[model samples]
Target: MNRLPRLRGQLFERHEITVEKDIVRARQAVGRAMDGLGAKAIRKTRLVTAASEIFRNGLNYGGGAVALIHCDAGNRMVWVDCIDDGPGIEDMALALRDGYTSGTGLGRGLGGAKRLVDEFDIVSEPGVGTHVRLAGRA
Candidate 1:
């Protein structure tokens, strides 16, 4: 399921920051997004690092997208989901490689994203979009 809980003090935040070459804004947006979802120092750092990459991908490559930050009460988890309706990845496997890029990309992409989180889920289609959901516990 792509749904997260709406618990109190949850502080879920959604944003559609512009992807106009301002990666700093993207990073801050992510940090602010996870301010109080029961995140600790290490976990929040990991999540923000992953989020910065995804946010940049959305802004730089995709035609921009939305970021979803929410709490998973059932699992005591904090999740971040970024969705973009940009030109879908042509080769999912290749794009996931540690150093794969089609220009305007840093090549870290999915590999780095996966390493930063406890759980990662990704789905993409050529003409559709990309949906990435990452989870980390408090």
Candidate 2:
């Protein structure tokens, strides 16, 4: 997985990752939650795509992780957090660049996700795991 950004906040919903099929549910849950919270359609679509990439990384490379999606209406924003527990990225810079994937992917996951969100943050440790948080304001 690429170097992911870290974010901290009280997440209202949490989903565990154990198998591949969970990715579909993960994507749906996040999209519905954001929609229920009044997030715009475009925001939901972008975030859904980003969430898919993040979940893919979490399972494929990071082994597994939990997905946290929150809608802060008081703050007029929606955010998603994914935490993985595999060997973290060693080169943060390379992971952020385009066409630099270490796995079989097209290397658009991290960079594309970043572009889709209004705010993006990633934090990882070599021995630990990775934390990625993305947000959008509607």
Candidate 3:
């Protein structure tokens, strides 16, 4: 017989990223979640930074977005999903590259966020929208 992992505690939080202030809220929410999971200071900071970058990208490039935060206590892991309904990236490769920005910023958002998390996934459709998933382990 195969054994599956036992389930423990789980957390779910959602935030709408429609404005500049929402990004700050999302970062705070992420920090709180990480702290609850007993994540170290550096881990919490990295996750919060990654969340902020993703939120900004979704708001600036995707026109707006929603963020869903999840925590699995048994696994000591947390992840966030940012979904946006706007003009999506035409070239994911170019978009993920460092210093590649369609806007005025330095263009380090996507790549930098990826480096901060343990897991990262991004999907986009040119005429549809984009979804970014970032995860970290405590």
Candidate 4:
């Protein structure tokens, strides 16, 4: 008879991981969550890709943020919430448009993040903070 491996549940927290050039670390963090949840390779890749971009935006433009990865038996989810007390987006509609980057161009911006994730939520206030939440199940 074959036996299934026992499942493990864990909650992880990463704080103050700068978002500017830490794309590699952000990818690693999301990859860990995907692997821990037993996500297939393809699914894991997609999730990590989307998450890496989101993390970068939060770090580079938004200033910085944190991540919360949660896993349980039979399912896994990653929650990335980036907060920055900087000049928040004055026009969210314009900000979410593709190819709208405050710095550079040539790639889809926040809109790409929204399209790539299973779930996405964002809120911001001028002179306060920008909060972006992205979640995916595997």
Candidate 5:
């Protein structure tokens, strides 16, 4: 497997969330990494959904590529950043609206994802692509 290096802290390992079977792989990796790291069922589920949302959005809206970098933030918190280099969002506010969709999706992805995480940051430019970082206590 032509894979990226896995980063680990204690029993936790970080991974890149991409397409194919890697999304499932990444979810399992996260579950293993957060087990007993104070990751509650609700928070873990939320983070997983948030992770899935960003990856799908990156493939659909971005340039068919996305990078999800996960790491331990010490103190039982895990941080993940979903980065992409594609034509960026045209309007941030509009894009974040509950029922906004640039494609055929239901349009609730970004907004719903925001509700699932403790911290959410999205940055993009017309030609610069998009980067979304999500952090939460697991």
Candidate 6:
């Protein structure tokens, strides 16, 4: 139920997530951005993993999605927003819990992503769409 803010900072890359390949591109984009920001290896990996999970969720559950990568030079942070127009989650709390999945996966996408990032926010409206933001320090 936490609302994600509008994408801010310098948007270095934008990718449309319509297929499996797009997810890889998004992850690579994020990784490169983190590298450019001088993020530590663990931090870069965590952020990329978080971004990939959200991208996969958008593609598999949201039907498709888009990833916008942003860099906050002042804060030395990199973040990504993954958005989709699929049916919004009906139970936000339940969805955030581990071991609770609406799909065939292990039910750790959202929660695992959250643990891997420095900042996490998600907003979804039933019948509307879902927006997930993941951020990490560089």
The candidate that achieves the highest TM-score relative to the unseen native structure: 6
Provide TM-scores for the models. 0.80, 0.89, 0.91, 0.80, 0.80, 0.96
Model 3: how far residue 130 lies from native, Å: 0.4
Writing each residue's lDDT as its tens digit, candidate 1 over 31-106 gives 6545555567788889788887777777777778777777656576777777888777888889889788988567
Candidates 1 and 2 compared by lDDT, better number: 2
Which model is ahead, 2 or 5, in terms of lDDT? Answer: 2
The residue-by-residue lDDT of candidate 3 on 38-101, one tens digit each, is 9999999898899899999999988999998888888888888888988988998999899999
Worst 10-residue lDDT window, candidate 3: 1-10
Tens digit of lDDT per residue, candidate 2, span 18-93? 7888888888987887777788798889988998899889999899989988777777677888899889889988
Q: Using alpha carbons, what is the TM-score of model 1?
A: 0.80
How well is each residue in 29-129 modelled by candidate 4, as lDDT tens digits?
77787777777787777777777776777777777766544455455666555556667788889888876778886458678878877777788887776
Give the per-residue lDDT of model 6 (tens digit) for 1-138.
345767678998999999999999999999999999999999999999999999999999999998999999889999899999999999999999999999999999999999999999999999888999999999
Evaluated against the true structure, the overall lDDT of model 1 is 0.72
Model 6 spans > 4 angstroms off: 1-3
Residue 48 lDDT in candidate 4 = 78
lDDT of each: 0.72, 0.83, 0.86, 0.68, 0.69, 0.94
Candidate 3 off by > 4 Å: 1-11
Q: Lowest summed-lDDT stretch of 10 residues in model 2?
A: 1-10
| Model 4 stretches with alpha carbons more than 4 Å out | 1-10, 19-21, 72-75
Candidate 4, position 12, lDDT: 55
* Clash numbers, per candidate: 0, 5, 0, 1, 1, 0
